[model samples]
Target: MGGVGHWVVIFAIGGAQAVLLALALWRRPVNRAANRVLAAWLGLVGLDLGVKAAFLAAPAPGLFRVLLFVGVFPFLYGSFFYLYVRTLTTARRLAWLDGVHLSGFAVAFAVGLPALLAAPDTNLANMQAWLAGAFPPPVPWYSPFLYAWSLSYVAAAVWRVLRFRREVRERRSDADRVSLHWVMAMAMGQVLIWGIAVVHDYVRPAGIGYFTIYGAVAVWACVLGYLGLMQATVAGDDTAEPGAPREVPPDPPAAPPAQDEDARLPEVQARLAGLMEDEAMYLAPALTIAQVARRSGYPEYLVSAAINRGFGCTFWDYINRQRIAAACRCLADASDTRTILDIAYACGFTSKSTFNSAFKRETGHTPSAWRARQAAA
Candidate 1:
């Protein structure tokens, strides 16, 4: 594609990102604060890409360059992204100290403000000089600092994702398909892009590498938008107190006496089965592994391990199995005149689609089909 075509493509991607951000903000997700933070991060990204596309297409001299200078720092974007992931995973609100992450951007902006406020001719002249390989601007000295800031936040984000994954294994059954994976992918993508930009700066000044980086960024925005649309939105109690126990990491199984180890497994299995069968704890739509552990008076890891070993499924699948079984009973009851949705809700399903899928997956037929078969029999 020609320059205009490329610019059009970038702008289109940026526009889509903005729309996705709006959708995320509009929805009342379970974690509203996290959703808003993510929307803000996406907004910054969209603004950055949109401005870059405009500059590329028009190539204005003074004001445009100043705008580019202000918009190009990825530090703020990195901080927002890290905070979004942290809040989403931890179910925590932003703290006052989080503002410190943007201090680098603030300092950089202040340092560059004089040039931006200089006479239009002087600003244009400086731009030409920089383009012509004259003395580098003060901004270049801060390049390493900016990169370091971005990398540190990306590292923090990755760490948070890893911790979240560990907690999910301990506390969630359907952990494999959770939304955290998308956040992990996005963080890794940022690392790769930033790494490439660093290499481009040191190895070659051809300026072509920047286009490649920006193009990758545009593509990343599209991917994020698509994932945001497809992924399930979290919906639950948003009143969790700050520093509340959001997740508990699984503890490693302690070594027992050789005979005790073998006997302990069956005991754990019995307790878990009793909790599900007798107590009917699976009826809670928001039931979690941690909750089950607390109810059964067992350690969270032991409960998860028991379910995994005895049922050969994740905590999510095991609970869903119980729910589906309960749903089957309701579906087969001729006296229960309730609708499918009502039955789904009674069986602890949060959404109709989730209920339908789980029912079909467990039983070889949809709820309606199963009901029809029961009537026929």
Candidate 2:
């Protein structure tokens, strides 16, 4: 039948992509890896659109579009899968491999060498036959290779999430389940999009072309990402309601309106920083919002307000930053006389697992590795 259905899906999908990329850029302090990966993925999206344009207008449409859609785009999918997980979980961890990532850039240079060359435009039937015979869905070799590269990253991210979930559940540690949910949300989105694409490849019907298949798949992705972002915004609020009255000293005029975000933010940041430097609220065995606020001569309500508005990190991440910050000192100091558990507890973390996870979040390296690096230096 036809390609390029309606104006709405185009605007809708494009809007969703822009919103996600914007939110990721605005909210995350550690999103460089995700940013790089998203940039590459977006570039692929552009390439997909370009090939579809060529399919409509080119005299050799069958050849050029087939080569691009089958061989080139499939390889790009491999890179996209790797980057999406890397974007969500370990942007910092992969920073060292920047040089290796750059080496792949010199791949185009290899085409000039005798043994290497770029792909030529091929017939649609021949390309389809090539994909069907050699590189099928879950291609055993192709699809799974991208997945294998993500395996360790997935495991590490899952461990942090589950570990954080356990801590929030037990009330023994400060990390929350929100971050866990965020990671899981991203994983589910990836699986759903990729899963449909794989299924469509085999169960192909006559009129459902490559552009339509990818367009359909991307529609689902945009929907899921939109829903996830909406939930993240709601869940990020520390207070139950935006304009609800805060815990006051039983006085009406003395307390300001609950949602005075701009007026309170600087005060919150400074007070929270003071609590961190002075009381070392981070190092307490069971630090509570009540305790920190009281120590700072403020209400617990005000403290939560400060945390949510000023830092944008949850109370969990906020306190963990302090504990993790302390852990860095012990890590750097080289305590021959102390154990990791001791350092962990001393830094206000209740358990080794919590300490290890939080340390990784703050520094991207494990505490032992950090210490070793210092020692090596």
TM-scores, all candidates, are 0.65, 0.41
Best by lDDT: 1
What lDDT score belongs to each candidate, Candidate 1 first? 0.73, 0.54
Which regions of candidate 1 are displaced past 4 Å?
A: 1-5, 12-16, 23-30, 129-140, 205-207, 233-269, 273-287, 294-377
Task: Write down the worst ten-residue block by lDDT for model 1.
Answer: 228-237
Best by TM-score: 1
**For model 2, how does the per-residue alpha-carbon lDDT over 283-342 read when each residue is reduced to its tens digit?**
776566766766887766677777766677667778888888887888788555587778
What digit string (tens of lDDT, one per residue) describes model 1 on residues 32-124? Answer: 677777767677677777776665565567545655474546768678778888777766777888789788788878877777676779878
